[model samples]
Target chain A: MTNSTSIPIKLQDRSATEEFVQKFDTFLFDCDGVLWLGSHLLPLVVETLEYLKSLGKQLLFVTNNSTKSRSQYVKKFAGFGIEVTEDQIFTSGYASALYVRDFLKLTPGQDRVWIFGENGIKEELNIMGFDTSGGNDPRLDEPFDVATSPFLKDGLDDQVKCVIAGLDTKINYHRLAITLQYLRKPEVHFVATNIDSTFPQKGLILPGAGSAINSLSYASDRTPEACGKPNLNMLNAIVKAKGLDRSKCCMVGDRLNTDIKFGETGGLGGTLLVLTGIETEERALDNTHGNPSPKYYTSKLGNLYEFTH
Target chain B: MTNSTSIPIKLQDRSATEEFVQKFDTFLFDCDGVLWLGSHLLPLVVETLEYLKSLGKQLLFVTNNSTKSRSQYVKKFAGFGIEVTEDQIFTSGYASALYVRDFLKLTPGQDRVWIFGENGIKEELNIMGFDTSGGNDPRLDEPFDVATSPFLKDGLDDQVKCVIAGLDTKINYHRLAITLQYLRKPEVHFVATNIDSTFPQKGLILPGAGSAINSLSYASDRTPEACGKPNLNMLNAIVKAKGLDRSKCCMVGDRLNTDIKFGETGGLGGTLLVLTGIETEERALDNTHGNPSPKYYTSKLGNLYEFTH
Candidate 1:
């Protein structure tokens, strides 16, 4: 397994970082207030993306927020100079869609879906070839054939197959009531985006999909089948997409919740936490969260090239 | 007090019916399938009412199904007999609304409501001058506001006053999740229609609101205040409305679960069970569910009139 603390010093400038990139065929990035908030991009964000690719790195940006469409994030990323197509990005939403589809053996494009989150998650379900025509309209919350997404309904008698809790407006009482109902059904599957309570936003703290994950797990008496980061599914997907070994890949993230934690738990080459986001080593020490600490931590990213030196 | 055992003979035919009408000052009826099925009326139920009224007696139907509107039931019963108004009817739905509104000091028109049942119940809330504006459409099962209702939108973390469980079409896992979440808070009230496990349909039985009631109550560790018949509030409502002496009123019904049982606990007159719907004398004899048995039991409706005679 890779440790963030062991990131070697041979990495400097675009060339040196490029050498590390060539050494490892795969790369992963974190989303949410990390890339952009709503429609605004962070400073030097575009240069960071351009610098990585010029050095020959295989990049994959992962987000736990399933509320927006991947294209929406793609559009958001593009605004920050990280040019990418839908295929290059992986979201917890997409993983959740696939998980439900395979678990139920639902014929692709056959079952109806009731969505409660963003369009990106919905589009990903579409891309995976699942049917999502419900649009979460209340008139259709009944015990239908199969509903992929567990959108918020108007009342207490709608049927839902799975509760794909990504990011809804707020994890309020009504949502909890429905999720708890489905969870009690021993046969139903409960999948959450990521267990990240807070994520970085323009360098400020914000709540993440973890809040929903925590509530559902506790109320339903079922541990969620997580699909986003620090999990085998996403790592396996990245490895398959790039045709690289999971052991040799590096998952770069500025926050310990995703980037560094993924590197340590997912067995990537190593983790690199940029002070630009999430937690600091001092904070990590104080909290002692995540049994193990990040392998390496840097104050800020004036230049990724500087790390290669 | 009126008995469920018989048709007042005086009410049965002119002068005879008048003699019968002089016997009792108040009446009570159960909701669920007894009142209407979704929206259909039962057979020959109207003539009996006119017969009883012709003899001149007060009537109050007590129900465990707290999902219907008194006005709605009034409108429904109108289809059965002549000239019935909302005030002439009684429902647990109205009782619960009043209890929640008065006991909780809930400003109906001002608070956001996270509703879980039917339109009849919702209509009653509106009539009570509550903020007929809904909180989260319980149909989506996902709560817009987790703790407080969006109906009032107090914008406080703990502002949700109560969760009303009526007949909701979108009651799913999400709604359960939300209900459990808010119920954990001491301030939020968990109110339910009735603890009826199965609702009568034509002849077969299907699960009723009690299922949802059980789900949330068990998971959240909060015993909701039940408002339907057989509950104390229902009995109190009858006493308040009729000015009837509790010792004199006799609860007559075909079901032992709600009507007959209430006599053992809730302070109504003793009970008489008729063999038309829920209970049979054999089952009652085989195992009188609780320790005490109902005051009387007979082969069917109008048998009570014979006993009274």
Candidate 2:
């Protein structure tokens, strides 16, 4: 996979920046490190996004975080003074919902989608017109006891056709026990919003979707189909839903393994790595992560504003 | 890894039984399924153990169940009308404590062992005289929020030399969060009692020690040294503690991957597979599980008593 282009071209040059910007009609962006880190907006992000908007570029936020719905993302974008519509943002939660509805195609009223996640997944699945159970249920909050757990005592729901796992901060043994009940069945399918092990927030590394997914998977001895970044399933869902030409899309993020690899593997027009978050310029240039290299990189997302001038 | 000896010899034959009984002086036995599954004792379990005891064979109960301590197991055995001492039982909890104290060899006082397990692990560590924290802590029951978690907010303890994981029914995001904090540090060693994904109890398959270990490993991006079953660490520990000759030791278990393989890999005198539990007689003869074949096979542990008559 090595080539002269494997060394990502720095988009600092005015002409090179212009060419890179002109090549993509739609920009798919990762949120955490690119646009903001936690609640704080990164430097010149609004200005750079505004510059892209002035040039008529379609802006779509794609994130592996399954904790927030599209509507919640719209609110988060608004909180940062960036104008974004709910339709333009795709979260792993939404992607998982799409995967369950479109890909798995469970029969309505017959096949139930069991969720081992939070309200974000429930909200997305609800928006998609799918009936789901075990999402942010207060009953799961009760301490787990093998003899008393209704989930364990009453047996599993036979109608569950698929089990979708996402980030669950309220994750407990009860939630995982119910999820394992479905996953252990040969007929039930398993899907993960993302297999990201951890995500950085507020200077603390927090357990991500994979923690929930991995626990259930380990317990059930089943591997789930991931519907997040670099999976191609999430990318296909976005492309088919938006009707965008793959040749005109670019992925921008600070993570090489997720955001950059997602674009590269999906055969998008370009992938730009930003060094404002998890990845560094040296690690990106090292070419040994086994993840696909980004086509171009800059010091930060704000550096792309230089292209407009 | 394949040979003619792969075909396990059935002990139903009188001469074969005699040879098997005469071959080993010390017998390492798995607790669950082999003796009593959950609370009830298996058929003729007492008679079989008595027969072995009458023959002057030293019997030791080695279990992957990390939720119970040696003393607890002694009570359990007593409840089942069996006579056993604390030293005769080697639970995964005790194995984990041994792993932390002897294997990792953490400096006393200066290096504390952090636990992500239940009372069993804590009790064993306390008996081993290692300073431990985070085992079955009632405070971890509080709802997880990034702003409120003391483990997350106060930062990680620098004195942690090893993080030992066992079966924790009270497993929550908070416990995992703190465990992740310690595991993320390069200096902290990771260890697991056993990686048994699920265990059968009350006709329900429940999540096992691997559920806790896998989640932490996934989040921390670290592999733990497992001290249960087929891992020679537990076997070596038992051998070292008992001062037993490997050629005089025989392992009798109802599982192939963990019990039989543990004996086989540890180069014991013989490994006997009992069909009253997880493994079927048909599967034992198939020789396709990628696990080493047991040296002998029988219908149940009770069948061994026939040799004494």
Question: Number of the top candidate by TM-score?
Answer: 2
C-alpha lDDT (0 to 100) for residue A253 of candidate 2: 87
Interface RMSD of 2: 1.0
Tell me the lDDT of model 1 at A192. 74
* Model 1 misplaced regions, further than 4 Å: A1-30, A42-59, A67-72, A100-103, A106-133, A136-309, B1-28, B47-59, B62-69, B82-93, B106-309
Model 2 Cα lDDT, one tens digit per residue, A1-309? 223245788888778888989999999999997888888798889999999999999999999988889999888889888888988999998888888887788776567889998788888888767788887878788876667876667677787888889888888878877777788899999999999888777667778888778889888888999999979998988898899998899999887778888998888988899988788888778777687788888988988885556
The global C-alpha lDDT for each of the candidates, from Candidate 1 onward, is 0.58, 0.84
Error of 1 at A222 (Å): 12
Candidate 2 chain B minimal-lDDT segment of 10 residues:
B1-10
lDDT of 2 by residue, B1-309 (tens): 213266788988678887889888999999887987787678888998998899999999999988888888888888888989988988888888887877677766668888888778878887777788887777787866677877667767777788989888888888888788888889889889899888776666778889878989988889999989978889988998899999889899988889988988888888899987777888889876677788888988887776656
Q: Provide the DockQ value for model 1.
A: 0.04
TM-score of chain A of each: 0.78, 0.94
TM-score, chain B, model 1, is 0.77
